[model samples]
Target chain A: MSAGLSIAREEWRLWARSRVVLLAGVIVAVLLVVTSALTALRVADEAEARAARQASAEATFLAQPDRHPHRMVHYGHYAFRTPPPLAAFDPGVDAVTGQSIFLEGHRQNTAMFADARAGADLGGFAGLTPANIYQLLLPLLLIIIGHGVLLRERESGTLAVLLAQGQSALTLAGGKALALAGVVGAFLLPVTALAAYGAARGEPALTAALMVAGYGLYLAVWAALILAVSLWVRQRSVALGVLIFVWLLTALVVPRLGINAGSAAIDAPGKIESDLVMLAEQRKLGDGHNAADPAFAALQKQVLEQYGAEKVEELPMNWRGVVAGYSEKKLTDLMNQYAEKRMAQEAEQSRIVTLFGFASPTLAVGAASRTLAGTDLATHHRFLREAEALRFDFVQGLNDLHATKLTFADDAKRSADPEAEKRTRVNAAAWRLLDDFRFVPDPAAARAARAALPLAMLLGWLVLLGGAIVAGARRLRP
Target chain B: MIPALEARSLSLVRDGTTVLEDVSFTVAPGEIYALLGGNGAGKSTTLLTFLGFLAPSCGSVLVNGRAVAEDVDGARSAIAYLPEAASLYGHLDAYENLGYFLDLAARKVSRAAMDEALDQVALPREARGRRMQSYSKGMRQKTAIALALLRDTPILLLDEPTSGLDPVAIDEFHDMLKGLADAGRSVLMVTHDVYGACQVADRVGLLRGGRLVGSFEAAAGERIDTETVHAAFAAREAA
Candidate 1:
């Protein structure tokens, strides 16, 4: 056997003999299995529940009683986003971003019932998913197992003897790194199995493989880091302390700090502020309610010119419905503009967070994992956008029915005249004509493209860390 | 004949302080040289330089006629080292540790060969499979010696190899050193045991203030006593 392999084999034998190491390994494996099973179960339950709720909402919308088209518009509809399949592996940003959104004409609602808000007693800490365990805890286990790999040799005067036996320092460092990396691989096996199972259950095979790659690179970074520290530091105690501190700074502290930094760097307008702004813009632009508010005078003239009619009474269709459609167009356009601005701001904040990946590779891997899992903010925004589009289509369809089926005279007189109100009611069959809200996920190619930057950043971290390990190996001395 | 190990007026300065100065020595094939010194007399420093752990500020260290600085690995391949209190992996058995070290030295030996090497060093067959952590000082040293025998290097460097061994174990260790020298291997041992040096070394050199001040040869039909070795260190202290 090669010297490096021999060293690694001996290290494995020693680890097998050590009861504490074996116990710790078993505990980590058990925790990973239990947590992964629980997370998968929870995610599956949520997905099924969301699908059922969505079906019920659609049924309720289509089962509305015969009523005036405007009244039905006021009733609105709800859109519940089902969790993506990979969320079982890494439910990134899912807990914080609510699942269901209320869509209506002239208004866009924020997604409500976020998991984080519902489980506020845990304060965003309730979801101890397997991904979190692997990213945060497994590295600590590696540190504990490997911190003494080199320092013990130094302290016991074995390093000098080993070197004198013609073992190059680089080979020794490589051997220890290989041993620790093997531990890392063992720790990752359960996670890989979970991902493979996820893929087998009809999840995107490429996405599952990407998740494994992202996390595998993450653990490899830790292995290299632990080995580097173990070889560079002179004392076991100091190495332990340094590695623990690194874990704290990278895994725990940097993510939180990055969020704060991102928020501070790019200010996303609050929901209330956005809503108030959109409301003011609507009022200034003219509420779609009034037919002769002078705002639609130009629109009225345009409709008349197109039909070649000199007066409203001469028009074939109800002028009220035409005015409503025109006004609705203006309102929807303004709302879309505001939504785009808000999305831009959110994107900027996310960009700032991504930039911090240079400071901590953990953050980079987290970003890449979320992007591949399709639970990121961008996916949430996509859901909202699709819901908004469906709302426009259904509301506009109702307005079209009112213009053709109900007479202009009856619609105007319905508030005062009971018989006219009865005449203005459209049949319940019209509701069935409206299309259902369906969210088409972003294409896999698009997700892969979006995740490339963070993935590259992670790879960059690995390269730099690899360089440091090599440099450290060169400096090794008894 | 080429010397198995040679130091040519070697001088080493650590942290701007001279630890070894103008010291020179050689051990021929089938010879044992013992260096006696007080604390901080550069005995260990010379061994470190010869092991290529440190580069001399002036002069050179050659193992098997190759400069250690220019060809560290090549020079190292020709030597074996047993450090003071020689420690192996506490978690690994003696045979396993020896096998690991042998692999490190780029030599692959069979289990029977390993057992034979252990036998040569008087390590009990049963103790070969026991973890080094449970071994006494003598047993650990014997394991280290077994590794050296497995390496089969022409030159051996030992730094206080018998410092903590019991009298009987030390006697056995001395016999092992004699056996190694008779087998055409060269050994250089650094110690403070004057009587032990007189019993086993082919020649004994006394070092004081980083300099080799006195030398006695057992091979030259010279009867060197413990008092003569003590006087060499005492005179340096008096000066």
Candidate 2:
């Protein structure tokens, strides 16, 4: 153990003295941190702008004059996106997913204006996150630093001397691994600091901890594998080349293969198709303009009977308001069902993706990060659900006000008489009664639970690589 | 008494091809034994077998009565190997590389002792502090000898140690080997230069067809000539 520590210390001293190693490590750390912090700020600004637009849309909806509740249902309401507070750590698929969802009486609208899969064909490769640094590029750097550990000694004819000195192959390997892990730790420190910073700001502490743990485990695999390959090869050049190949295959090749395979397995319906389907479904429900239809006429008769009215004018409630309330209820239910189905399809797609986390810890961590941040597909779906709920409440409230305040005769005649229509406008007090959209993210406890599986996989990797250390050490003995 | 280094009927087959077969030789303490052969004569192969770098397909290599392949570290600890071109970490200065090898060899000599070892090999004091990447061939060879001295092993194996040295350095290297022998160490040297072998070796062995086909002992009034040695090497090749 003392020998191992001494060797570890020696490696660190060498690295410190070697300008190239120190420069490479520092440059990568600085670049990743700066890029991550800047990107986080940019995303936060975008989210704020989106929220402001939502506020303006809500204000516009409230400014409307009094009208039949059914007409107000046709006018609809816009729901703005509420960005997750922890999204600065990892945006997940938030950029790729739609933010705002327009909810109306009859048709469901898929969230639109997502930035994912945007730009030219090659643009999608560089996802917006510090994860790429940890996942793809970091291993390559480890390979560069670690591949020559044993082979160089052999090439220089120093292995015999080292062996003669009571240094077992296991000891040498242990020392090298210790050295590499130290370098990997230095590389991860800055990113972990960023994550911890987010965690410090009331970001889910457990999720942040898990993220750090997962990344560390993943990089450990690289370090051990690098040493293993270096020991297995006869020449230092071959060792370096072989390790680079392994890194490329595992980090870049396999992940893209997994993502493409998942997409091929279950392709979600395109947005255009979803919109057309929602439209077709809405037409099947009773249209508000078709008052001659039996369903509409029956609804009107029911309202009169329920109020115990002798005639339309004798009724305290406006007939137009009653028509609008009934219209809003039917269409809102239709839109909600459509939404539920689309969200289900998206859930299916994401479920397939999450299963692949086992094959690649990167996928697992990516999923867990997004889920914890409330920036994953599920969160987007929830936001849409809440937005639709608010839309329903707003449209329905207007319908109820028309039914109670305006007489049936007054509502029916107001559409034809501009003067009466102007007088029928509801007071500002009524508009104030409409609720504003509020987002309640899934609880932090639930996020930690959601991240548990990936965290466990990451832990499993750490244990497995630790085992590799023992196994590789045994093989190195003369 | 056990030979300082010995191999009997040793064979090395790599990738289904026999590179060496039925190779046998022995070196006793206080003797400089030379292994002479043409290109591809397996001189380096025979030396590597003693170090256990290549496993023998048949028979065995023994260092001080222990099979080296079975006790690699033990055998390696007892010997120093200087390969052709002598690859020291080019990024490390001569002194640093020497320090590293000595450390590996389990020797804990002081920094001053390391400097003295380099001085014994006639290395320039100024060059000791510069990285080896800038060293000339003679400087590199001297540093390798300096490493061997610092290791203080009982046996030494040199593969073309004087290949690129100047006449002065080559003479100096042979004297160093002779001095090592006088101190009761054994040295096995492989070289293509027959004249140098005759000058430095107490006994010269001719390797042809992966076997030691001829050997001559050094004695008073019996100095081996280059022509006779070359003729013997060619005859072994023809046979």
Candidate 3:
């Protein structure tokens, strides 16, 4: 242990003396801090934009002229999903999912316009949060530094002298790993502070801690792999090439393949197909336009009988309000069922992709980061579900007020007379009863549990790294 | 007493090519043995196998009576090797490079001891503080010598130790080798410079076809001239 520590210290001494290593490490750390600040700013901006939109929507809804409840049902409400606080750390799939969704009685629209990948190189480069830096950028830098550790000794013919002087293979490997670990730690500092910040703010501290652990293990894996290759390959060039190839495979190729496989396995309906299908289902269930439609007419008859009225004019209640409420119920059910089916498809796709997590921990980590930040597909789905439920409640509440309060003859004549329609409008009393949109973050424990799979893969990588150390040690004899 | 370094029928085969075959020799304490050979004559190969950098196909290499490949560190600690070009980390100064190698060697000597060792190699005080990349060939060679001395191992291996040096530097290098041997250390070096070998070696061996074909003692009695040594080397190359 002492020997390993000493060797590690020596590595630091050498690393410090090497301007390139020092520069690279400093550049990485600076980039992390700058990116963290930028990500926080971006998330804050997004929150503000969404908040303003939500306020404007509420104001617009309140400013509407008095009208029959059924006419108001078609006006709909717009809700924008505000990102959770921890999202500033990871911002996961938030960009890919839409931000605002338009919801109305008898119709559902998908959340639109939130994808992060919509822009050019600037957008791609803009997503360099601390976690992204650790996952993709840090390993490659480590590869450049660590791949030549022992190979340089051999090249210079000093390795033999070092061995002659009683440096054990285990000590050598351990020391080199220790030295590289320091570099890795330096790179992780910004993210670690960010994690601590999240914890202080009462976000998922445990999840943040797990992220740090995962990243450390990931970097350690690279260090070990580099050393192993350095020992296995005789020349400096060969060792470097092998390490670069491994980095490419793990960081870029595997994740892309995993995503492609995911899409192939569980194909979700395109937005257009989902919209068309929902429209078709809506027509099938009930349409207020077709009075001859059995489902619609039956609903009308049932309401009339309940009110003890043989004809629509004789009823004190508004018939149009009753019919509108019934149609809204049928359409809401259909949309919910379709949305659930689509979510299930997406879930299946995600499950298939996560199967590749063991091969590439970055994908697993990326997903976990997004999930913890409440910006993943699941979070988006939750927001959509909550917003749709709220829309149903608000529209239904208005319909109920219209049915029992307004006279059927008055509501029918309101359609022809502007002043009568104004009289038929439900007052602000109904609007005040409906709730505002609220976004809930995923629980801390749940985030940790969700991150478990990636953590396991990181552990697996640790084992593999340990194996490489042993194997490399064995090969070091000659 | 056991030889400081020995190869008993040591051989090496790589990718179906015989790089070294049945090479046997020894350098006892207070002795200098120069190995002379043509290009690809397996001189460097023999040294690497002894250092446990290359695994021998047959027989064994013993440093201080222990097989090198069997106990890599034990064998390595018993010897210091100087490659032909003596490449050091270009980014590090002489002192820094030496410090790093000493650490790798697991030596606990202080900075003063390292400087003392550099002084023994006759390296100029100014050169020791300069980056090795900016060093001249002779200066780099001097640093390699200083490193071997700092290691203070029983045996020293050199591949063409005098390949690139001025006459003054070459003479100084020979004097250092002699001094090391006089201090009861064994020196096994590969060189074609018959005159330089004669200056430092107690004996010399000729390598041909991956085999040590001839061995010559360099004592005052029966001492050979540069002409005879050159002819013998030429004959071996032709053969």
Candidate 4:
């Protein structure tokens, strides 16, 4: 056998005989399996619940009784976001981002019932999810196993004997790295199986592949880093201390700091502030509620001139409906402008956090995993945009119904005369004619493209860590 | 004929401090050379320089006529080393440890060969299969010696090989060294045990302050006395 393999075999033998290492391995394996299974079940359950809620909301909308088209607009629709199948492997931002949005006329509501808000106590802990285990705990396990790989030899004086026996330091280091990499592979098996199951169950194959590739690179980075530290540090205890500190700094501390830094770097307006601004803009532009408001007097005159009519009575259509449509369009434009600004700000915060990935491979892999799973801030924004578009179409369609189907004479007399009020009610069949709001997720290629940067950052870390290992090996001596 | 090991005016500096200075020595084939020194006397530093673990600031260490710095692996392949307290993987059995290190040295041995080396080193056949962690210091030494025998190198480098062994175990270890010397292998030992050196070494060198100051040889059919070796160390202290 080659010297590296021989060394690795001895390490395997040693690990087998060590009850502590064996017990640690078993505990980590059990944690991985249980967390992965629970995450898959939770994701699947949420998806089913969201689909059911969406169906129920659609049914309720179409079942409305006869009412004025404007009343129907007030009874707005609900849009529920469905998680992609691969979310089982990595729920990503789904734990924090809200899952359902309320859509109505002249208003866009924020998504509500986010887990972070609902499960406040547990949200800070991330609920023992699979991604959390891989991100936080698995690397710790690697550090425990590998911190002594070289230090033991040095402490025991086997290093001198081995060196004098013609064993190159590179071969010894390579052997230890190979051994730890084997452990990494074993740790990754259950998660890889979960990802494959997701792919087989109709999740995008390319996304599953990318997720697995990303995690492989991530774990490899840890293994290389652990080995490098082991070889470079002089004492076993010191090596362990250094590795633990590294794990804490990179995995636990830096991500939180990066998020805070990112938030500090880019400011996003809160919901109330944005709502107040939109309200102010709405007032400044024109109130769609009153047809005779001075804000639309100019619009009314322009309409009269375009139709060559001197007054509303001479117009071909109910001028009230035309005025309502114009006001709805103006309000929709103002709402979209503010919403886009807020999304841009949130995106900037996320970008700042992504830049820190260059320093911490853990964060890089976490970002890539979320992006590929379609559970990131970008995906959340996409859902909101799609929901807004659907809302505009649904509300505007009702406005068109008001313009063409309901007569202005009846609408104007409805409050005073019961018969006129009854005549102004459109048929409930119109609700059924409106299309359901369906959110189509971005294609696998698009998500892969979006995630490509973080993934490359992770790969870059792996390459740099490989260089460290090589340099450490070159410097190994007794 | 090429000497098994030679150091000509070797000097080594570590961390900007000179640890070994102008040391010269040679161990011909089938001869045993023991170096005696107090703590910080640069005995271990000399061995490390010979193993190419530390490069000399001046001169060179040659194994079988090849400079250690110029061809470290080639020089190392000709040596089997035993540290002051030879340590093996605590979890592995003596035989397994022997096989592993032998394989590390690019020598694959059969089970019977491993058993023979263990037996030759006087380690009990039953104890060879048990974990080395439970073995006593003497047994660990025997295991290290068995590894050296299995390596079958031309030269053996031992750093205080008998320091921790009991008197009886030390005597047996001296006999083992004598047997290796008789078998045409050169041995260089670094130790504080003057009597142990007199018993096993053909020539003894006294080191003081990183320099070899005095030497005594055991002529044919003659053994160097303990007092003669003591006087050499005393003379250096007086000077």
Candidate 5:
């Protein structure tokens, strides 16, 4: 213990003298502070804007004067997903996935207003969030700082001196790791403060804690690996070169290339393709307005049988509204089937990309961090599904009003006869009965559950690197 | 008393080739022994074996009468080793280097004692606080020697200890070795300088092609002859 601690102390003393490393550390600390504060402000402003827009959309729909209920269904509403509180820290897929959906009848709209669509580098490093600093930059900084820890000693012949001082190779390795851990902790300070701020601002405490834990483990993995490689290699330049390559592979190359490959392999249908296919299928269901259309012959007869009437005038309520309601159910079913298949493919792609985490702790911590932040793929999908549900519910409510509120004789010739058209309009107060679109984000337990495997993968990396350090210590050159 | 350091028929093979072949030597308490050899003649390899950095391919190397292979850390604990040129951390001052190394040895010394050791090595007190990166080769060597002195171990192993020192510094270093020997500490230093080896050693061994080909010893209160040992070394290399 004395040997290890002394080694660690000496290392710290040496680092204090290294101007370049110290300067780099100071710069990174300041960068994290400035970027995280800016991100918090952006998130707050975005949430407010989305809420305002959602309210405006609802007001616009309800403000309409008396009109055919069918017209209200076409007028539609909007659902805006308020940013998750922890988005100030991670932001995850939010920048690429969009936050608002246009919820109209018959058509299930994709989310609009994604930053990626606005040419924001797909939320790449150009986006500059705190999560990027933790996932990408910290490990690279550690690599640059500690790559030569052991090699410098051996090259300068100090390793022999230390070894001859009765320091076991294992102890020397342990001491270096302890010292590196100190540096990693120092780097984590700003992020730790960010976590505290988030918790104070009402983000889930467990998620913040886990984010902190995941990042710590992620850096520890890099530290152990740096020591192990330094112990194994013979030269400082070689260790630096090898570690940089490793950093590049883990932090950048694998994640981008692997996700792209996974997405390619799954071949999920695009929004345009799915929409075109649905339009074709909807055509088979025919136009819902014309009760004389052959597509509704069976439905028209069914209504007539129920009423024991031979024709439209004999029915008490308008038959067109019943047909409109029935046709909508079929179209929504088609929309659901396509939506579920697309979501399944998207989920599969995300799963495959997550499997790449096994190769890179950076990816593992990234996935876990985003999940805890409630900005992951599942959350985005949840928003879409919920918006669709509200779209279906409100559209059908309008259809029910259309059927029971107006007479068949007035609705059929309303276009040609002004009096009939005036009689056909329903009360303007009917829009009040519609359900509002409120986004329910996944619970903390669900986020924690989804993050479980990625966090475990990070743990697995730490353990694996730890095992390498132990095994490599024995092989350390004196 | 058990020999302070011993190598009983030590031989080492690395990468399918032998570097040391059946070499045997010992230093009694208070004795100064030097192994003289040219490059790749295995002088450093023998010192490494005593420190247990390299396991013996055959035979045994021991320190304080314990088999080094069986108790390597114990062997290392009993000895202080100074490598060729003694490259201390260029970013650390002499005092910091000594303190760090002494800390690694799990021993603590007072600042006054550290000053005393540095004074004995003739290192400038002003330079003791400056980073070694600005130090001359001789100053760095002096700092390493001060570190070895501070270790206070019963046995010392030095590989090319006087490589960068001037004639005056070399003389001072040889005199220090004699004083250490007189105080009953054993030393085993490996070097190629015939005069330097003859100047300090109570006994000397000549190594050629990884074999100990010749040996010399001084009478009581005397030193080995440089000319005779140098002649023998040249003859063996020529053969």
Candidate 6:
């Protein structure tokens, strides 16, 4: 262990003395700091803007003039999908997906006002978030710095001296790996601080801890891989070339392959096609607009039976409002079925893409980081689901007022009689009955649960590469 | 007593090519034996087999009477190797490189002791603190010799130990090596310097085409004749 520490310390001294390597490390660290700051600012500005807009929306809803409850239903509220707090570290899919959904009656709305759609060239392959840098560039940096350590030993005749000193191959490899891990840890300084920062700010500690561990394992895999390859190849140039090729294969090429393969393997319906199918499916189901049609005659009979009314006018409440309530429920359920199916398809696509995480550490960490940050597709789907629930609740709340407040005769004669139309309007204060919509993210435990598979894959890579290093170290010769 | 270093019928074949044949030699304790050969004569190959860096196709090498193949660590623990053109870390000064390599051997030395070893090799005190990258070939060779000396092992393996030294330093190195041998250390050095081998070595073995062609041993208080070995070397190359 002392010998290993000696080598590790020597490696550090050598690196510090090397101006080029030190400069590269400084540059990467500066980039991480700058990107981290910029991402934090962007997330803050976005969250503030969304919150302000949401507040304004609620104020406008409550200030509405007296009107028929149906008109108030059309003045729908907006649920802004608030950025998950740790998005400063990893924006994930948040940049591409829309943030706000316009919740109204009858139709389920797609989210809107996405950063990508607003011409923000960010957060995907070109993403400069701290997570992106850690995932993509950190491994490359490790490869560039470590590709020559073992090769230099043989090239400089130091291996023979080291070996002749009773140093086993295992010790040499262990020492080299220790040195590389130290370098990687230096890179993680900002990451560790970011986690602590997130934890202090009330992001789930487990999620933050898992994110750091996932990256730790990921970098370990690279460190071991670099050492193993350097030990296996004797020539300096060959070791460097092979390591660079591997970096490109895993970092650049394999991730793209995963996405393309997932798309080809399980092609989900395009947005337009999905929308059209849902529209067609809705048409074949109950026509909520014609509440008095034969399609809802059974619903009318059920309502009458519940009220024990001899005639529609004789009932205590307006029958049209009752029909509105029943029809909306049936229509909402149909929409939910389609929405869930689409979500399932997308989740399947993600699953197919994630299987490639085994092929690339970049993919594994990216998946795990995004899921932990609550910036993944699953979170977005959750937002839509929550918005739909709010949509139904508010719409139903207005429908209930429609049923209880207005008389059946007043609603029927309102279009033809001006006096009845005035009386048919419910007070705008009724909008206060609706609750303000706040997006509650999935519990931290659930998000961590979802991240398990990719994190395990990262761990698996570490084990496989670590084992190879051990096996290869035994074969190392001067 | 068992010989401090021995190669019994040692042979090596690398990449389907014979690098060393069934050659045999041993250096007893307190003796200096030099294996002299021209380039590609399997001189370095012999040293590597003893270090367990390369496995011989047939036969075995032993250090301190233990087969190197069976207890490589044990064999290596007793030996200090100085490879040809022995490159120290250019990024580190002499003390740091020496300290690192010595530490790997699990030996501890004080700065004064390091300075002493450096002084014995005649490396100027002023140049010892500078990175070896700034040093000339001869200076680097001197630092490597210091490292090997500081290892304090029983056996020493020097591959072309005086390749870059001037006449004065080469003589100084030979005397230092002789002093180590006198102190009960065994030396097995491979070199193509016929005159230097005859000047310092107690026994000189001529290696030709992976075979030990001839050996010359000095009598007590006498040195091996250089011209005789040189002519044999020249004749073998001519053939």
Q: Which residue pairs collide in model 4, if any?
A: none
Model 4 lDDT, residue A376, Cα:
90
Interface RMSD of 6: 1.1
Which has the greatest DockQ? 4
Q: What DockQ does each candidate score versus the true complex, computed on alpha carbons? A: 0.81, 0.24, 0.42, 0.85, 0.81, 0.81
Query: CAPRI band of model 1?
Result: high
Model 3 ranges off by over 4 Å: A22-34, A63-67, A113-134, A288-293, A300-320, A407-409, A416-423, B54-56, B67-72, B221-224
Off by over 4 Å in 1: A117-125, B219-223, B237-239
Instruction: Give the least accurate 10-residue stretch of model 2 chain B, judged by summed lDDT.
Output: B98-107
Q: How would you encode candidate 6's per-residue C-alpha lDDT over B1-239 as one tens digit per residue?
A: 89999989988998988888999999999999999999999999999999988988999999999999999888888888888877689988899988888777777899999999999878999998898899987788888878877887888899998987889878888988898899898999999999999999999999988999889999889999999989988998898
lDDT: worst 10-residue window of model 3 chain A: A112-121
Instruction: In candidate 5, list every pair of residues with a backbone clash.
Output: none
Ranking by TM-score: 4, 5, 6, 1, 3, 2
Q: In every candidate, what fraction of the native interface contacts is reproduced?
A: 0.91, 0.20, 0.56, 0.91, 0.91, 0.91
Per-residue lDDT of model 3, residues A367-413, tens digit only: 66676666777778788788888889988887887778787666777
TM-score for each predicted model, relative to the true structure: 0.95, 0.84, 0.90, 0.96, 0.96, 0.95
True contacts kept of 5: 0.91
In candidate 3, the residue pairs with backbone N, CA or C atoms under 3 Å apart (3 or more residues apart, or in different chains) clash, namely A95-A114, A95-A115, A95-A116, A164-B76, A164-B77, A165-B77
Candidate 5 per-residue lDDT, tens place, A1-478, comes to 4888888887888788899789878878876876687677667766777778778888898999999999999888788887766788888889888889877777888897565522343354337888988888888888878988888889989998888877889999999999999988887777677777777877778877877877888888898889989988899999999999999998999999779978888999877798887788889987877778899898878888998999977888888888888888988998899999999998899898998999988888888988988889999988888888888888899889888998888989999999999987888998896675567667778888999998899889888888888888887767
Candidate 6 ranges beyond 4 A from true positions: A117-126, A301-311, B166-168, B219-222
For A1-478, candidate 4 gives per-residue lDDT tens digits of 7878888888887887888889988988787777677666666666676777767877888898888898888788788777777777777777777778877887888886465532443453336778878888889988888789888999999888887887888999999988887777787787778778878877788988888888888888898888888888899899889989988898988898899998888878876699896786689777776788899989999989999999876777777777788998998888889989999998998988988898888899899989988889999999989888888888888888888888878888889999999988888998975666666667999999999999999888888888888898898887
lDDT of 2 by residue, B1-239 (tens): 88999988888888887788887888998889999998988998888788776789999999999998789778888887777877676777987787666664457878898888888878899888998889987788888778878888889888888998889888888888888899888999999889999988888999876767888887764656778888897777776
Winner on lDDT between 4 and 5 is 5
Backbone clashes in model 4: 0
lDDT of 6: 0.86
